[model samples]
Target: MNPLAHLRPALDAGLVELGLAAPALSARLLDYLALLDRWNRAYNLTAIRDPREMVVKHLLDSLAMAPFVGDETLADLGTGPGLPGIPLALARPGLRVTLVESNGKKARFLREAVRRLGLANARVAGCRAEALDEPGAYDCLTARALGTLAELVRVGGHLLKPGGRLLAMKGLAPADEIAALPPDWHASAVHALRVPGLDAERHLVVVTRRAA
Candidate 1:
């Protein structure tokens, strides 16, 4: 039995549920999953071994935030295996994505994935998130399973332009982390995401900087 045969239907269903009903985009997403699956065997890029689970957890979970992404430059901090960044880039061809990763192997995998997927709007940055010093370089930033809201803003805040947004994906509605946000920043909205076929509680924390 072919894995994509099983995975395709689920992926298609999930994408439609997420309001991404484009057949062409769905096909490209599956291509990314196939590439990730093939590399995982050798590089262990992701801990999720099952392809079906990847469809739900990685693909759908990431795409769940597509509705909230703005059409501008986005920097994905600690983008291991290019989560929301890669998928978002595929969905929005006009959006430029910069995937920042420190690990050599994962960074290599990201570069290869971008090349093989022919994502001309995407690029890989082989460095740590905190080391990025491009103040106001991006209009939006994303971090998936990366860190607390405070920590993410503390390190990646400089990368965002004034009035820019940070979309942080987390398992739960981290109240404590939200409470701990820097005084200069505030939670604009916290959206609870519903990833198709995923029973886990997923939330997208939308944070923005306060004017000086």
Candidate 2:
């Protein structure tokens, strides 16, 4: 049986559970997985070698945060292989997604993925998060397994609009990291995400700046 044929049902079932039952979006997500699997062979973008694990860990894990993303424009900091950003863009065509990756090879892969996927709403930024000087530019900012909560805010805080939120995807609830957040920032909410087919603990931390 074809690899995609084996993966399609799982992806479809996962998407439906996530309330993202659009056929077109599901196809794009599978295409992205194929691209990532191909590139991982050469670039070693992700350590997980099995495509089945990729479906659950990469695709479904990222899509789990889709419901929390309500911003028109989103910036994905340290987006290696465009995990959640690309998938999110596929799910929400109207969302403007900027994928920021400092690695040249990963950045190139991201550019190619965007081109190949025909994701007109997504773009790649080959630079570090702190280097991005666009203050209050995006309505929401996202980072998946990128860094601690404090570090993420310190680096990408400027990219968020005044009332925007930072959606950080983590394996477990980082209570210490949340407590260490800067005085100006506050933890608005922490949502426990139940990614389909993934048994690990998944959490989405929503952070915002304190009002003056």
The C-alpha TM-scores of every prediction are: 0.96, 0.97
> How many pairs of residues collide in each model?
0, 0
Can you write out model 1's per-residue Cα lDDT over 7-60, one digit (the tens) per residue?
777888998899998988888888888889988999999999999899999989
Q: Distance (Å) between predicted and true CA of 22, model 2?
A: 1.8
Model 2, C-alpha of 195: deviation from truth (Å)? 0.4
**Model 2 compared with the native: what TM-score?**
0.97
Q: lDDT for each of the candidates?
A: 0.91, 0.91
* Candidate with the greatest TM-score versus the true structure: 2
Clashing pairs in 1: none
